[model samples]
Structures are given as structure tokens and as C-alpha cells.
Target: MIRNDIRALDAYHVPDASGLIKLDAMENPYPLPDTLRRTLAERLANADIHRYPDAAMENLREKIAARHGLAPEQILLGNGSDEIIQMLMIAADQGACAAPAPSFVMYELIAKWIRRPFTAISLDEHFNLDADRFLQVVSREKASLAFLACPNNPTGNFWAADVVERIASDFGGLLVIDEAYAPFADRDHLHLINEHVLVLRTFSKIGWAGLRLGYAVGQASLISELNKVRLPYNINTLTQIAADVLLDHFHVFDEQATRIRCERERMQRALAAFPDLQTYPSQTNFITIRVPDAGQAFAHLLKKRILIKQLGGHALLENCLRITIGTPEQNDQVLEALKELFK
Candidate 1:
């Protein structure tokens, strides 16, 4: 029999990623160029399958540390950024309390999974963090773990950095910053890693989505505790090697990210011209737009085989749709489909 919390929990909803234009998940739609794919295939062709992965993920950790300009001791790798979130909640709650928001789904889900007392602070109408409100609730409740998504999901807007820093300082608990979308944004609190905060990042967005690699940068002491709870061999040999290879070629993806940023700006500007639609300024790779009758628009896009994230019931995001920036051609197709729908 399932635990009461497990039974009461809403099932995690993942859409059918089978065949549409597939933009719903905030994934990089560009496939690896032929040369990179061939290199990866050749590298994996000789990987030692019989042996287990390095439990410490030493090499991958080093690569991440070098890229982020931190020491290896400051980084803790995860199966994905999701696992880093779970690890932080477990470490902070220690089987007791977790606090997230109405916008982020994982913090609540994971808290429930761990059977912790979870509380949600609602966001303002613009999907911005109500810092005073959030701090007020956390202070009164004395929650030990707080999860905030910068450039928050579904809404695609970055909450102010100073506000997050204030929370971390004032709240004597673990403050987790899920920066899964940070690369696309202009501001970040990575400098806050030295402070009372833990930052999570993933290769999934940059260009290594299939590798399922994510990591947390925080104080060494905190990272060690998380390491203690993580499953041994959690990250496999192939993933470790693949991540190392990609990190070596980091500039390839950096160039791609630059192009995506350019395309995202252009897409946002173009979408703004359409009447009856309000596109939110995005710091991440995606943009969230308030459409007139989002359900009808979502369904209409589906019919045109153009998929985007529908944020119908998400607190301040009602009637909003999130669209990830794809390659130039893919973006053109999405814009064309929208024009057809609204024309």
C-alpha cells in the first residue's frame, strides 16, 4: 500500500513528447551537429560497460567546477537538476518541512514524496516573487527549506537577485536557487554560492539534454552532506564520459546559446506585434505569453503540430503559454502558426 501522502499526491503530468514540434519541455530543439554525434558515438563505442561508474563522479565534477570557476569541492553532481532539488530538500528537511511556491511543481511534489510538511507562497500577478510575502510566510512558519526558481518555470521571468539574497541572509535555513535556466539569463547568484545558498544547474538546456546531467554549487560542507545521502553509482560511466567530452567542447554549445539568445529576442519582439497577446519579457530561453483563451490557442497550435507549454492553472500564469526558442526555422514555423491562428 502507498503511504498516505503518496496516495494523496497528484500524479506528475508529462505530456506526450512523441511527434509534435516538441517545445513544451524547455528543451534545446537543435540536435548535435554530425561531427559531434560521430565523436560521441565513437567515444561511447569503447566505454567500459561491465564496470560501475565513479561514485564521486570526479572527472565530471572537475569539469563543472572549472567551467563555473569554483573548486571541485563546491560542486555536487546529480542525475538531473531534479535530483539536486530532491537532495537539497532531503538535507534541509531531514524528513520534516519544505516550502516552495504555487508556480514550481517539483518542490511540492518532492516534499510530498518525502512526506515533509510543504507550504506554498503565491506569486504576484506578473509571476514575480512577492518577496515580502514569501519572507513573511517563511518567517512565521520557520520553514527549513525554501526552493526558488530564478527565471521561474512556465512564467519565464527572473525574480530579482537582491531579493533572493535577502531571503537567504534573513532566513536561517537552506535557500536553494534552481538556476536550470540561468545560462540564458543576464543575472545570476552564482556569486552567492559562497553565501548561505545552494545553486543548481544542468547541462540539459545548454546542449547535453540526453546526458541527464545536473549539478549543485554550494558550500563544501553542505555538498558533503548531500553526497552522503545520494545513491552510489547514481551517475553511470557512459553519462560521466559523455559529460566530460561535452565540457571539453563547451564553447561549441556557448556559441549555440548565443545564437538562441539572439533568436529568442527576435521571437519575443515578433510575438509582441500580434494583437490580443501579451508576451512577458524572458531571461531564459523561453517566453511566456498571455493569450486570449489559452486553452483554445493551445489546442489550435496542437492541431497545427506546434506544441508549447500551457500554464492554465499556474497561480499568476492563468491563460499563459510558454514557448521555447528553437532554431530559426522552427521559430519561424511557430510564429507562422500563431499568425494563422490569430489572423
Candidate 2:
């Protein structure tokens, strides 16, 4: 029989986005160029399916590290950042897992699966963290691990560097700075990595979602410990080969991200012009807005074959919808749909 907690938990839901414009998930809207797609196909075709993947993935690690100017020894791979989050929770010292409320949900959900205590420090009305208060809770709860999503999801705003670094310096525990949106952000905090701090990232949002690849950058010893908890052959042979080949052409993804950022700005400006909508400035490829009626707007978009993430149930995010930036045509369609609803 399953544990009562496990039984009581509701399974995570991924709504059917089939036949919709498909902006519910924050994915790169652009597809690989035909040439690159053919190249990747050729590389993947050469992979030996009979053999297990490169468990250590040394070459891939070196390639990823070189991009960040870190050593291969400092890298740890996971099927995706979610797997890495679970590994960190499983390997950390026995104590509470902490994070700011209204941030990523996985930190708390995975902690619960492990039966670890979880603490959420609520953000202020403006969705900003108070560093001093966060540390106070972490210390009082004796939290041994924490996760902070940079340019936080759902809200799509980056916290001040001083605020984040202060928590990293004062907290006596493992701290993960998740930079899943780093490619779209104006800054990164790799310089803060140390014994108790790690930066997590995923290629999913950057256009390799189908590959399910993620990684962590930390001090060599810390990464080594997290590696112990990773499942054997977690990344398959095909994914490994594809990732290795794709990293060589990372400029393609970078260019796509630049275009998304530009679209995000354009979308922000357009959304702000609506008198009934309140838009938050974003540093990621998504924009979150508080609309006059989230339900109405969401339904309107769906009727028009569009899909977006409606983040309800949280007081701070009430009547809010998170819109992933898409190509020019997709964005234009969204604007037109909203205009029809509000007109």
C-alpha cells in the first residue's frame, strides 16, 4: 500500500495542449532549421542503441562546462532539473527544505515525496523576497536545503543580486540557484557557486525539451556528492548524442532566445496598453499579467485555438495568466484574441 501522504497527493496535471497554439508551457517556439534537423538526425542515427548511454557523459560535461567557463569535474547531469532537485533533496542532511512562496512548486512537492519538512517564506505584495526574513525562517526551521528560481517562473521577474547572494552567504545549508531562464536573462550568478551553493539549469526551455536534459554547476566536491544520487544511465544514448551535437550549434538557440526576448518586450508593451490588464516587467521569455477576468480571457483564447498558463489558487497570483513569448504571428494572434475579448 502506498503511504497516506503519497495517496493523498494529487498527481501533477499537464493539460492537453494538442491542436492549440501551444503556449501553455514555456518552450522555445522556433523549430530547428531543416539543415540542423538533418544534421541532428544523422548524429542520432549513428548512436549505438544496444549500448547504455555514457553514464559519466564526460565529453558532454566538458562541452557544457566550456560554455560556462567551468571544469567538467564541476558538472552534474540529470534527466532534467526535476531529477536533480530530487537528488539534492535525497542527498542533503536531514532537515527542512525551504523556498519562497509563489516560486517553483517542485521544491516543496519533491521534498514531500521524500517525507522531508518543507517551509515556504511568502513574498511581499510586489512578489519580492525580503532576504532578512527568509534567512530568519531558514535558521529557525534548521532548513538544510533551499531552491531559488532566478527570474522566477509564474512571476517572470529576477530578484536583486544582493538579496539572493545574502541568502547564499548566511544560510548554513545547500542552496540551489535555478537559472532555467538564464539564456533570456540579462545576468547570471555563476560567480556565487561554492561548497554549499549550486546553480541548476535545463535545456528544455531553450528548445531541447524533447531531449529532457538538465545540469548543475557547483564546486567539484559538491557536484560529486549529487552525482552519487543520480540514476544510472538516466540520460539515454540518443539524447546524449543529440545534446553533444546540438551544443556545437548553440548559437542557433541563442539567436532564437534573442528573438523571444524581443517578442516578450513587444508583448509586454501591447498588454500594458489594455486598461484592464496589469503587466509585470519580465526578464524571462514569459510575461505574467493580471487581467480583469482570468477565466474569461483564458476561455476566450482557448476558443480561438490558443493555450496559456492560468495560475490561479494563489492569492498573489489570483486572476493572473503567464504567457510564453512565441513567434511574431503567434503573438499577434494572442493580441487579437485578447482585443476581441475586451472590446
Candidate 3:
């Protein structure tokens, strides 16, 4: 028999979305434009695939550090932001713990897999963090790690900066600020890396999801501890090279992000017009909207070959659905389809 936790655990499900508009996964809808795609193809065309990747991936580290205005020593790369979360749990040396409510799902799942005690501190009715309760739990120091999604997923709202700062100031334990959606958000705690916080970021949302590149920035000592638990050469040669190439032409990534931001704002405003809909203000590239019946809306969109995420099981997320901002045309299609549904 498997471990009791493993047996009881429900595996993460990604809905089959073949031939749909595919907005459910919070993915960037645009493919790399022809020029960049060709460049990436050319780079990989003659690359050495036989040899092992650079253990340190120094060049990629330097590129990331320069982009963030940090020293290379402060950065630790992971296969993806998900791996970075696992590394943080390992670094905190916690077994099992409940994460704050309405955060990224991975935090709780990872804790359970590690057999750590986990509890969720539910957000207030508006899906905002209950900082007071959160502080109380941390002061108890029962769990070794606490995870916060800065611009929280599903809700698509960024926590107030002052609130996060206050928690960092008060909490003595490790605080992981997962900024996977940072590129689209205006605010971040990246400046708080020297504090009791570790900031996790990734290229997944921006344009390089397929590469599985993510990084954590923290005090050198803490990052060193995380490095020990991470497998050597976890990022392969091609990924490192591709990340480096993309970073070198980061303007391309920025342009795409700008487009997505525009699309998100347009979508949000249009969503606001629906009588039965409640659209939450978002700093990330996705919008979370409360509908009269989210499951029905999700099913209706599916029938039109458009897909969006249904926030059914998530706390405080009842009757809500999340839509990733797509290209101008895709956004129009979604809006038109949704208009028909609500009309």
C-alpha cells in the first residue's frame, strides 16, 4: 500500500482542451513570432545535445541577475517555479503545513506530499489576505514555511504592498513570495529579498513556459541551503541557452507582455458590463470574474470550443472563473461568445 497521504491525495487535473481556444491554463496565447522562433530554431539546430549541461549554468544566472539588477550569487535556478516551491519547502525543513487560503494550489499539495502538517488561513470574503490571522499563525511558529502568491492566482489580485511588508517585518519564519505573475503586475517584493522573504519568479508566464525556467532570489546563505536540496544540473543545456538567448532580446518578451496587459484591461472593462457578472480588479494578465453560475458558464464556453478555468474547489472562489488574456482576436471571440451566453 502507498503512504496514506499519497493514497488519499487527488492528483492535479488538467482538463482535456484539444481544439479549444485554451484559455484555462493561464498560458500566453501568442506563439513566439516568426523571427524569434527562427532564431531559437537556428540556435538549437547545431547545438551539442550529447554532453551534460553546465552544472552551474553560470551564463544564464548572470543574464537573470543582470535583468533583475542583482548579483549572480543571489539567484538560484529551478526547473520551473514549481520546483522552486519544493526547494523552498526543503530549505524550511518543514514536513507538512497548511498554506494561506486562496493561494496557488501547489503550496498545499507540496506540503501534503512532504507529509508536513498544513492548514489554510482563509482569506476575507473579498479574497484578500487576512494579515492579522496570518501573523497570529506565524507567531505560533507551528509550520516551518508560509507561501504567499503576491498577485494571487485564480483571484488575480495583487496583495497590498504595505500588508506584505508588515508581515515580513513581523514574521520570523521563512516567507516565500511566489511572483510567477510578476511580469504582468505593477508591484512586487523583489526588493525584500534581503528580508525574511524568498521571491520566486519564472519565465513560464512571460514567453518561455516550454523551457521550464524559474529562479528564486534570497540572501546568499538561504539560497545556498536550497541549492543543496536541488538536483545538480536540474536545468538542461538547451534550456539555459534558450533562456540566455531570450533574455538577450528581452525587449521581445516585454512587447508581448505589454500586449497581454492591454488585452487584460480591455477584457476586464468589457466584463464589467455584464449585469450578473462581478469582475475583480487584476494586476496579473488574467481576470477572475464572478458569474451567476460559473460551472454553467464554463460548460457553455467549452461548447463553443473556448476554454477558461473554473474555480470550483478553491476557497472564497465560489461561482468564479478565471480567464487568461488572449490575443486581440481571441479576446474578441471570447467576449462575443460570452455576450451570447449572458444575453
Alpha-carbon runs more than 4 Å astray in model 2: none
lDDT by residue for model 2 (108-193), tens: 89999999999999888788999999999999999999999998987999989899999989999999999999999999989999
Best by TM-score: 2
| Per-model root-mean-square deviation over C-alphas | 1.6, 0.8, 1.4
Deviation in Å, model 2, residue 100 alpha carbon:
0.5
TM value for model 1: 0.95
User: Could you tell me the lDDT of residue 321 within candidate 1?
Assistant: 89
lDDT of 3 by residue, 27-126 (tens): 8888888898889888887678898888987778887888878888789999998998887776675533546678788887887787667778788878
Angstrom error at residue 257, model 3: 0.6
Model 3, runs deviating above 4 Å: 95-98
Ranking by lDDT: 2, 3, 1
Give candidate 2's whole-model lDDT.
0.92
Task: Count backbone overlaps in model 3.
Answer: 8
Cα deviation in Å at residue 134, candidate 3?
0.9
Better of 2 and 3 by TM-score: 2
